[model samples]
Target: MKAASYDAYAPDNSRLRVGDVPDPRVGPGQVLVEVRAAGVNPVDWKVMAGGLDPIVEAVFPVIPGWDVAGVVAAVGVDTPEFEPGDEVISYARMPIIRHGTFAELVAVPAEFLARRPVALDWAAAGGLPLTGLTALRLLNRLEVTAGDVLLVYGAAGGVGSIAVQLGRERGARVIGTASPRNHDFVRGLGAEPVAYGEGQADRVRDLAPGGVTAVADCVGGQLDTTLAVLAFGGRHASIADPSVTEHGGSSVWTRPDGAALTELAALADQGVLTVEVSRTFPLEEVAAAFDASRTGHTRGKIILTP
Candidate 1:
């Protein structure tokens, strides 16, 4: 099998390369997926750069990716939930970084695999798992509900865009912050668009005079801004910053849950949720894909087709 791998932690990605590797082993309660597509996220490069080393230890010749959409090639012992030929999507992040989805095949635990939404194509499904799970977890952590006004920072990006839509589906009035060029794009996701920097809190206040009932910070470095516009006793969560907990907000980290992914998939099938894939690269072009994600300007998800 061919995979993108790095033998050492190199922030500049100098050691990252695509080459032939042995096929992944299907352990008990796991399934080997014939990789169709994979999602390129910030964490992919971050892991390669050793940014997550304090938490997730890396082994040499590590394959680096977490999001995948693929077909089950073989099922391991006791894994009765799925069989060969089943289409699935998974946030396949493991406790250690030895194997990942940026390869021709990946072994995913059955507990992490969910049926891919039929409404989404390969690239979209590949991109949906991690970002979708993050947005869902953040909204759940904030306890967003009907009649509440929810404000989302970085609303045009992957997690934020999905968060905006999910907020609207939950009957919350969502106001999303993005650049001027993406205002309409955010609006299309059912959020009232506000420009991100400078006086963003004021703009949010104008939209919801009582202040926002909940805040979801997908982008970091905005805790003060989030506090300024939050209604009294309101809840907030951040995926980017841990310091949010000091301000009475929760720092959310997405976990792999097949059940939650199943619900999200149903929402997509019902037309209540959609994934926007900004660009896609072939597996061999993983480096270019990482470069694009590093730009931090893409309006939606970037995908790697295997």
Candidate 2:
């Protein structure tokens, strides 16, 4: 099996290389996916540099990726939920990082696999899992509902874009923060766009004078602005900033749930949700893909095809 792997930690892409590795073994309650596309995320490189050291330990020569869309090649015992040739997508993060989606094949737990949405191509499906799940979790935690005013930070980025759409679908008036260049893009996602930075709080106040009912922070380090703009008794959560907890906000993290992924797929098939793919790279160009993700300016997803 060919994969992009690194022997040890390096903050940059200097250690990433494409090469042949031993094939993964299918264990009970697992399924083997023939990799078609893998999504590049900030966490991939961050994990390579020991960003998740305190939470999840990495094994040496790690293959870096979590989001995958592909066809099942085989199924392990007790895994009647999937069969060979079934197209699937998964946020395949495990406690250990030895095996990953950035390979010719990855063995994912059966509970992590969901049928891919018919509406999305391989690239879009590949990019949907992690970010979509993150947004879904954030919105769920915030209890966003009809008549609510929701503010999403980093609205044009992968998770933020999905959050904006989901918020709108739930009948909330969504206000999204992005750069001037992405204001139109954010608006297209069904959110009012406000440029983030100095005076961002004032800008959001102009849209929702009573303060937003909910805040979902996809980009971090804006706790002060979030506090300033959130309505009294409002709910708030941050995926990147834990300091939000001290200010009566929650720190949220995404988890793998095949059932939730299936619901997301249904939304896509119904034309209520869609993924935006910014770029696609070949397996050999993993380094370049990571470089693009590091820019932190991508409007949507950066994907890698195997």
Candidate 3:
């Protein structure tokens, strides 16, 4: 099979290249998926540059991608949850980096697989898992409720955009921070938009005079800003900043859960959630996809069509 792979970590993505690789071997409780599309995330390039080295051990000639949407081609022993031809989406992060979804095929543990939402196309389904999981986990940690006023920093990025919509679904009044150009885009996702940076706290205070009931910081480096506008005793969580723990907020890290993904899929099917794909690249163009994601300006997801 042809896959985009690298033998060593390179910050400039100089080692990432497409070439033929052996097919993955399905293990017990796993399924082999024919990759239709994969999502490119910041972690993909970060992993390439050894940013996750302490946490994820990388095997040489690593195929680097975790978000995948595809059809099940075969199932391993004892994997009864899915069968051939079933469409699935998975946050296929392994404890170690080795076989990945950027390839033409990948072997995924059944525990990480969820049926793709009927309403989503291939690229959108591929893009939904990681960001959706991040947003869902953050909201869950914050314990956002219908009556809460939730403020989201970096509201136009992948996780933040989804968080905005999910907050609205839970009946929270959401105020999202984005650049002026993206305010309309964020508003369309059901949040009142506020421009990020200088005086952001004041803008948020104007909208929620008493302060917001919860905060989800998808963008890092805003811990002080978050504290300034948070209601007394309100909950807050950050995906990017671990310093949140020192400020009475939790640092959220998403875990792969088939059940949670299923629920998110149902929301998509019900028209309560949607994924925006900002760009699509062929598998061979994975480098370019990473470049685009590094720009940090994309409003949604960058997809790689395999």
Candidate 4:
């Protein structure tokens, strides 16, 4: 299998190396996927760089992606929801516990797999699970609804972009923080864009004269930077650094929820949700991808086309 993996905690040693390995044997309740694409998340690089020291004990040098899309190569008998050749996307729980979708094949429990929208190919579909679930959970946790004013930090990036669209779908008055280059893109998603950095709080306040009712931080450094703009008692959720919570609004961390992924898949298929791919790389170029992630600036999610 052409897999991207490295020695434990040696992110720099990680490379796109080709080695022939025995194929996986499917167990009951599992489905085998001829992996097509894998979503790249910051956590993938963190796993390599040893930056997540607090949770290092629980982490592994495993293949680093959680979101995946592929065709079902096989299915267990007890799972009647799918069959051979079913195109699907999933946040693989078991493989994440061992290997991951950064290989030519991966096996996930049947329940985690959802049929991919015929409208989306592997790259777009693979990008959906992790960020999609994070966006969905954060918006739901903040209880954003119609007429509520919400401010999204990093609104032009992966999770932020999706949250902005979801917030609009839920009827929130959406304001987003992004670079000048992405102002139009975020606006296209229905968010009023506020430039991030000096005077950012002022810009947010200017956007919401009444006050920002809720905040979601997909960007790490923008929270303390936006403190003064949040309405008193406004909720906050973050998928990045929790230091943003110190600014007095709440913070959030993401977890993989199969059910939530299902909901996101449904929304995507219904044309109510979409995933943006800023760039795509083959499995061998993972080091360069991690370097890109370290820069902290990209238009959308980076994808690994396996």
Candidate 5:
């Protein structure tokens, strides 16, 4: 099977290569997905550069992807939940980074697989899992609810865009932070947009003078702005910054839950949620895709179709 792999931790992505790797083998309680599309994430590149070396060990020649949407080519023994031809999507991260989604095939635990939303095309579906799940978890952690004013940092990017919509769906008044160029885009996601950087807190105050009741920081380094605009006794959480914990906010991480993803899929089908895919690359162009992800300015997801 063809895959994109790295021989070692190379910050420049110089070791990245595309070639045939051994086909992933299915094990009991797992399903083999014939890859259709994979999502490129910042963590994918970070892992490639050994940024996560202390936490997660990587085998050399590691295939570099975690989000996938594809069809079940085969089911492992004892995997009664899925059969061949079932379309599915998953956050396919393993404790050990070896087999991954940036390949012709990947083996996923059955508990981590959810039926792909029919409302989304391959690229959108592929991009939905990780970011969507992260957004859901953050909102849940902050206990966002009707009558609460929610502020989402990085509102035009993958996780933030979904967080904006989900906050709106939960009946919160959402305020999102983005660049001047993305203000309209963020507004279209049902949030009032405030440009990030200097004076961002003032801008948010102008929108919600009572102060925001919740903050979901998708992009890090906004602890000051978040603290400034937060209402008295308000909740805050950050996926990118663990330092938030020291300031009375939670540092959040997403868990792989097929049930939660199934609910998100239903939201997509009901027109309450949508994924924005900025661009896509072929399997062989994984390097270019990673470079695009590193730009930190893309409006939505960069995907790879295998």
Candidate 6:
């Protein structure tokens, strides 16, 4: 199996290489997924750049992607939730300490594997897990509903894109923030698009009129703007900041839940939700995929096709 990995935190690329490796072997409470595709998340670069530990402790020489989607090539002992050849998608644990889906195989704790919707292809299913889980958690925090006015920051980005659709599915009058280029795209996802940047707060204010009952800030370094766009004391959550009006530390981040992943998969199967992956790169280009994730303004998810 070909795999790409980095050891120690330094700005050198020599250690990041694509090469053959023994297939992943499952242990009790774990399952081996024959990798088809993996999602390149911001956390991937954060781990490589020595920045991901704050969420969860990091392990060295790490296989660093957080999203996985593939077939269950082998099931761990005593695991009854899945079987061989099961099509699955999952948000691997934060910090994602073990080998990930960047190779031809990954060993995952069964708790992380969620059934992939049969209607979605491997790439589309792979594009989901992490972003969908994040979106589900954020929207849950926002308490979004049809009667509410929902505001989504970074609407064209991965999690934001899913939030737009999911928030709409929850019946909220969705107002999504995006650049002029993504306005039509955001609108097509069933949300009103508010151009982001400069006077983005004013744009949200105009779109939502009186106020926004809930807001999901997917953008970092823009908390002030996000807060300003929210209705007074209205529900607001951010996957990046994790800090609120009075809280501190990283305790506020949304905790991953397999149940939530299941709900998201149901949504995908039902056509009530969707996620877009902008590009797919192979394991050989792991470094470049991280570069793309770090670029900060992509329209959808970036995937690793192993």
Q: Once model 6 is optimally superposed onto the true structure by TM-score, how far is the C-alpha of residue 100 displaced, in angstroms?
A: 2.0
Candidate 3 lDDT by residue in tens digits, 205-285: 999999999999998999888889999989999998899899888999888888999999999999999999999999989
Worst 10 residues of 2 by lDDT: 8-17
lDDT assessment of candidate 1:
0.94
What are the per-residue Cα lDDT tens digits for candidate 6 across 15-49?
57677767777899888888898988886666666
In model 3, what is the error at residue 64, expressed in angstroms? 0.4
TM-score of 1: 0.99
The TM-score obtained by model 6 is 0.93
Clashing pairs in 6: 146-171
Candidate 6 off by > 4 Å: 11-14, 94-96, 247-254
Task: Put down candidate 5 lDDT per residue, 64-91, tens digits, no spaces.
Answer: 8999999999998999999999999999
* lDDT (tens digit, per residue) of candidate 2 on 128-186: 99999999999999999999999999999999999999999999999999999998888
Clashes of each: 0, 0, 0, 1, 0, 1
lDDT of 1 by residue, 133-242 (tens): 99999999988899989999999999999999999999999999999999999999999999988898888888888889899999999998888899998999999999
For each candidate, what is the lDDT? 0.94, 0.95, 0.94, 0.78, 0.94, 0.79
lDDT of 4 by residue, 70-172 (tens): 9999986687878898898887745234467888888788877778876677899988887887888889989999978988888888889999989998999
Q: Which model is ahead, 2 or 6, in terms of TM-score?
A: 2
> TM-scores of the models, in the given order?
0.99, 0.99, 0.99, 0.91, 0.99, 0.93
Model 5 off-target regions past 4 Å? none
TM-score of 4: 0.91
Clashes of 1: 0
Query: Which residue pairs of candidate 4 clash?
Result: 238-252
